[model samples]
Target chain A: MHFVDMLVHRWDLARALGRPYAAPDELTRVLNPCGGSAARLAPDDRLLPGDRPGRVTTPAIDDRDDRRGPRAEHGGPTALARRTGRKGSYPMWCSSVLRRPRRLFAVAVLAVAFPGLAACGSGSGGAASAAAPAYAPAATPTATSGAGAGGGTTPPSTPAPMPGMSGMATGAPGAGGATAAGKPVSATRVAIQNFAFSPATVTVKAGTTVTWTNQDSDPHTVTAKSGAGPDSPTLDQGATYQYTFTKAGQYAYLCTIHPFMLGTVVVTP
Target chain B: MSRRQLARHGAWFGAAVALSVVGGEVISSVVGGTTSAAAAADDTATLRFVQVSDSHLGFTGTANPDVTGSFAHAIDQVNALPYRPDFVMHTGDLTHLSTAAQFDQVKQMLGGVRAGSVHTVPGEHDAIHDHGRGYLSTFGAGSAGDGWYSFDLKGVHVLALVNTLSLEKLGHLGPDQLDFVRRDVAGLSSDTPILVFSHIPLFAMYPEWGWGTDDAAQALSHLRRFSSVTCLNGHVHQLFTKTEGTVTFHSATTTAYPLPRPGVGPAPTPQTLPAGRLRAALGIREVSHVQGQTTLAIKDSVLS
Candidate 1:
């Protein structure tokens, strides 16, 4: 775990000092699966041992698996991102590294050269990409296109994936063809800042997905005060969590991390 | 060296260190060294106590999926100590969301801890929604207004303060609390040892994150005459130490998740650490107050 911490710390330090950083080849090879198989990349989501800091045991990712894994026809940011489809394992590997212009090329080249591989890998990529899957894949048919759209424009400073709700919807209009009639669900955004939710009360349509973006640096969660309201994961600064209100009622919610941060979401028929 | 300079220099001593005031100047040295303060005390006479902070019970996040389990581990660690501590001071943030159920669960869990007694101050989380009325009902039995009170334990004056309430930009100690501090320590002699406990750090460790108290200086001024004053706090979810004049502040680590260091990120968000490292980041502190030493011997131990 120290290895990942050291790696993330190095990236954080480099970013803080305005320096460019790339992971060592050992971490890349050990963590990044050339096959791009989400199942093979599953172990990467768990904590790793720092016992062998400089040496990471390589996983078996070969060209033979290319036939078994997802398609790898085109290799640039768009193609690789489209593979983010149902499983978000690939973008999880890129994380902060995805923002660097050249790493995209490196990942693209990696994808083409290794036909089996669909995404690049780095330290705890799943942590950042976990926030992406919520809005990206469900709204789009390809499911994975959110990675390319959200990751491409995200700055290294904003390690969390850009709100896929905005970036992905526009970036991949073709992918949204399946749900074109009902696809473009305009989400009502609630700002969480200064330890309180802005506009404390929000009224939206029944099917509207109310997204809470934490503008505050401190962590916050949108939880139901009574019955079912908005149950969200911990939202860090620049990180977002959305809940679609399917029924019409007065749903009261508050930041579970800071219960005093109260807000109400009224859904109308 | 002048008294101010001596206290400032004494702060530099690392762990297992001892410090004392002599001729109006503080002197410090590594413990067990032939230092005047360490040599003068009898180890058996030391008053040993434990400090556990930010348990954040009922919290479940990626950083720590089982906060209740981890807090239980911390209490077990305290109980497994070779010697049961005189008392346990939980600096604050006992629950993630200050629900009555969370309070009850934490209270029952704390009851399992083997200590002389368990005391606490309120963290902002503890005052959630109701301004600490819920917390006061559960833990504020003998505490004064807003759960601030002081008591004498084995010749050491211990003050449990409430600075997490009515916070604006920083932790605030309103006039009522400040007055309590003045009156509490008014009769104590200059040589009496003083220990102040609060959830937010009294010193401006990082005001931008609301880590410091706005009116702590006033409270400190009332205790400045004492030969030794130590302030312990537990909000930032990380270990930090600062020394000013005669008082040294120590911020304890949480039994819950870890937060980013001051200015390390956009906000003091709980860091989602890689696996198997969460326990290393969460732990407890044991403080030993020796008879002759003005400063307590502080030792931080991580949960195994």
Candidate 2:
């Protein structure tokens, strides 16, 4: 079928399946671009095609000037039919068939297509297109409506790997074979020198472990104040210590040996 | 006139005149000697000195546990200086936990300094538990209300302001104290140097942490008429200095412990350092003011 015909057919199917259709006025504007009115759609309107004769009718046009009427039938549909030389009889057989099963069939079609049209209008299709697997609800007959409906956009279940990843990326490998969130965790090597910790402030996610290496000749202890209790063992020169911060806050620390040396760590969840 | 009458009258007049001349000579001699002695004392200039603050003794926390040791060490260092300071001034925070025992320990230790008498002010910690009762009992004899006092050293007019009491969000110099300062320096000439010492930083270093003094501007405003004013403070455990017009504000580091750098975290408080590095963290600063020079040269040295 032509694209326009296919679109109209789909719209009709959606409406027939109990899907909400545009209002009558909107429908008329969409269907009849030349300005069809609601009165034209009434059951007794005679402008309907032959198979559905008298689908619409107006009393003013049909029975105007009744006193002078019937003297000469020259201005009405009857006159027009005579002029055209077509039969005056209605198509009784077609109307009879349309009266019973046709209405039931239209209702059934609308009932089947209503949910699909509603889902499409709600932008669930866009969500499905972005991360199909992540957003895919469950295995069900209705789930098929999600596929190809969102134009292949789907949310990613796992973050994409990138070069120069700092092991901070979720699911990326870190130093010492630790992975962020279940992947290989990456290592972050921080050095303490000149009585000061390099990168005095560091930001990391919860469960990410930070390792401190003492490069200074003297020994230093990583002491957090009493309330800020996630602490590390005192690391001597050429020695290393590590701690995993489970909670998030500003952890201000200094070398127990060198009180002047100070650093901070910020953990974000 | 008869010879006898003339001779008697002349003798009486001559004796009276002679008495007047003797009285004049005696008065001149006494006044001249007093003026000469005062000039001699003035020629031997009085010593001017700087005030160090917040040396909290017996603070065993990491910020600086060996606070007393460092302070004693600082005293020894000061004593060993090439030129003996006229005297030393300790603005306040003389002890970490202001116990009678701590105050006693500070007195004994500071007594060993051969330089001169040490002037003291109260710190929040020193006054927190005792409400300054013990501080006053130990050091209050010559001091004014709540240990606020002033004295003259050399040519400088030194004022020790008590801010620990009436401590607001920042330090406070209440109306009474301000009025005292106004009257205290009212008679001094503009050329006379002035030094104001308090426990908290007079300028707004970091008000959220109570590192600054409120109403310092009022005290400072009173001092603006003077040609030279130096304001020294200690609280943040670090060194910071600023000069506004004729007033120079200096924040001295704590002899007890080092605090977190300002605004580096949610709030700033004393941080614990390793026992071995405590001495390195604590230090003393010396400020020398030459009379003719506009600037005071400051030297900070760590306690080895």
Candidate 3:
């Protein structure tokens, strides 16, 4: 009950400040202000976040037969994400250069793929010169000797914690102790990190006990969507919750604290 | 503006309305006098009010470590508005935990705001374990049936609804409130511009997160006849606008921490933005209705 109240109070403060409430319940969701539109979904529903139900219906304003209507389609954040591919909002020139290339080949490819690298390059002349930097090593002799000495001695100390790099490497399922024959192990671990369930979909044998460990600082809970499934209390950072799949069926679960973090356990008999 | 002149500015008016949907970008959109009849109707709209929501007082988290401080800033923002607002409506969630102390603290803080009167509708948070006994005692004055009431401000009829109580999956406005809505607006003419306030969205903004009111369809049925109906709510603390025929729904932002853009993250958890971006996500909304214009100007200003 206290948790629920915490959600509602989001607006009271944000409303007073005229700002976005940071409560889990009060994200800045913009829906059509007018009530009972067949098309409008809750601001959160607009985003196809994992298993959440609700189709993305364009806001009614977008249905208007006006040139301005097209822009309204991008009003919601999900729409904005879809429009920009979740990439940084770049100027038209950069986007145009990137869009024209079908496959990244060479000079044009390098320039379009890494716009930042070609920031100084401008127009057709710049595009041609942009390739020169890539081909020409342009190594100073003094720097080369220092690099030769360091390359052998300094074991690449700058491998500074790449959390995302490790996360991506382990994103594929079966990374959690699968047998060589691809058979599910009796016990496996699922890491909850980066607000996502690593190996979001797992295939496990019946009676397999799946243990979930929270790696992120935020708390999370494993709750079933329906039927009897894994239900765990709030798992704080470094906490572990184990649920044994006794029956053979597909069990879908999510972090109740973070519903978009969906996971599935395929329990095969 | 004359109809011909208004037509000349048609593109500009269209742009203004389009900007409103993006939340806080467009300040106002004047419906040009396409029909002299709409233009001539006595627009009893000389009213301006500020809406503050989701303060989540007593909350302490990285999303917003200083909710009270930010809420105080929100109060300051409201007081700093050029014109003294006639009333300030806090849609709901006055506190993070529905403790007696939290209620008293919010009441005192609200008292300091310079407005004619402060009004509020109970958010789900306001009705915790005791089922709103604490909230009602603190903020429920002259309200009917679990803190729902209506009053005429200027020419507009304003209805404060209670939809947070008895919520199943979505915010629920049981039969009593539904009946109240039907009877409340039955006497008013179809032209009366109505403003409906509730903590949860009276529309189906998102049922999965309980962001919407389940039975709001029935409540809204009673309002379809009105020429202009604007429903303002503050759950899903963000600015959103939707127009369904005569009815328009606007979801305001919060004074607390900002939540993720619907489903951008794993949950609607409070977002901990980079050090300087939290202010951009928090804001207050000012709504103005002119004496003779059908459109109401809603402006959302983020906390500086």
Candidate 4:
């Protein structure tokens, strides 16, 4: 699909610009998950009988029960991303996938029905983490405190969290213990500068409030990566958008206007 | 619905969620961007011009099977305007891949517009393999060193700048063009309403995506004394506006495909919205500055 082609293109650009990019581990995990997850298949993978010509399968949709909504947690690989043993971003991904009515039923079903397969995708996160240490949660906090116009907010002790890929494998040493206890950075301020969200990833305790201030001359947005997050109106210079995280999970976002300005919010319980 | 019927419904699916910012306040709306342009045109507006960007003429994506079709529809919107605009300015990206044929198709298609004159700048895509020799040769008449030039039109000075050539971290305006902007605006009075055009934004809209111009500040510094300045650009492929001092920056949407918002993803590629949402995401914008006004009144209407 075009998404795959785009992902490869992004890698090339990230390198060209000297920006850190996550290896396409989770993205290409299965290369073929059952039938409709991410990439369809490699040339060598055997095709399913129904996938062949003249099969005329009902539009690949599966209507799930209301109880198992698109946002419901499931163990599956197609999820946006999650560390091993952690809740995956699949639910949010499903919520966004449902935007297309024609494939809504099929993708919704894929999100909830295949959690068993989701387990396979998590193993790759741990391996990918070692490849990009610049994104580790520990080095996230920056020195400048982004407190409103009045000032007096101290920056977090940890370095600034990496931007771009928010899906680091924070699993405990033995793995499967996603309680990595992300360094709690009380300074919940993110500044938009040079077209990037400074401290691309932020860690906070559940129920904490975070604010994004735009320092760039042009407009930027704080939109959920899954199209399900509380999107902000376009913000110009000196404009700020605020949101409070009420749950513990990995919530990813990007500016709908400049999809390349990606950021993530990791909340710990 | 059948695939054909779903596509029929998809044509009307672009329900544009929009917002209007006046003087520093935000007003939001989620109307289906299907309203006609004539329905929003104003007769007494002081100055008027139609802004068209990202008309990727040769694009063949499922996002909208018929990019040329939608572009033609946009032309119809411009022709149907109740009052003829002083001039129609295409910010940039006229062709998807910068092909001679694509450029010709765009020129042939735009020839049908009812506006007084057609002016343009090059987008990175327009200069693809040919490096813009094709673009300048076709529409480069009267342009400066590159495809950047300025003209006085109906009391307004319009500058068409080409920043797509030799782009670095962001679109670049080398020393020559920056000097051109300096000398171009030096002769004009402080009261002239200035309209500057280019394919990429002159401001740092989102430098991460190369949406901003690297040395645009140097170009803008020359016009600080002007009472009104409107800078229009395409490339990010969306509608955004901002004002700083005497300058107002407007990033226009595309007549071809929509790209994700800044930081919404890893790249600014064509976005394929779910069916029934394409129209809301695609369309054209109309801008006008009244005689004594300091700001331009911009109206963005989506293709129904």
For this target, which candidate reaches the highest lDDT against the unseen true structure? 1
Give the Cα lDDT of each candidate.
0.56, 0.48, 0.54, 0.54
Please state the i-RMS of candidate 4.
18.4
What does the lDDT come to for candidate 4?
0.54
* DockQ for every prediction shown: 0.03, 0.01, 0.03, 0.03
- Give the DockQ (C-alpha) for candidate 4: 0.03
After superposition, the stretches of candidate 3 with alpha carbons farther than 4 Å from their true spots are: A1-67, A70-269, B1-45, B279-304
Cα lDDT tens digits, model 2, A7-103, are 3465555434645333234443443332322111121112222213212111111111211222112222222222222112211111232122233
lDDT string for model 4 (B1-304, tens) is: 2233322322332222222222222222222222233234453433455767777787776666788987887777666556576577787778866678998999998899777787889887777545589999989988879888888765777788888877644688889998999989988899787878888887655444566776777788898778767787888777665444467766776777777654343335456777886665554443434344533444445445
Question: For residues B1-304, what per-residue lDDT tens digits would candidate 2 score against the true structure?
Answer: 2223323222110010000011001000010011221122322354434345567776664455466666766666546444444566777888765678889998887787665577778877677434589889887889877778888765667898888766534577788898888889889888677778888777655443456666776777678778777777776676554444456666666555566544322224456657666445543333333445444344334444
Chain A TM-score, each candidate: 0.31, 0.30, 0.36, 0.33
Q: What is the TM-score of chain A in candidate 4?
A: 0.33
Model with the higher DockQ, candidate 1 or 2:
1
Off by over 4 Å in 2: A1-269, B1-43, B274-304
lDDT for each residue of candidate 3 in A72-160, tens digit (9 for 90 to 100) = 22232222221222211111212433211121112221322222223333454344223222111111111112212222211111111
Alpha-carbon TM-score of each model against the true structure: 0.51, 0.44, 0.52, 0.48
DockQ result, candidate 3? 0.03
Model 3 chain B lowest lDDT segment of ten: B13-22
Better of 1 and 2 by lDDT: 1
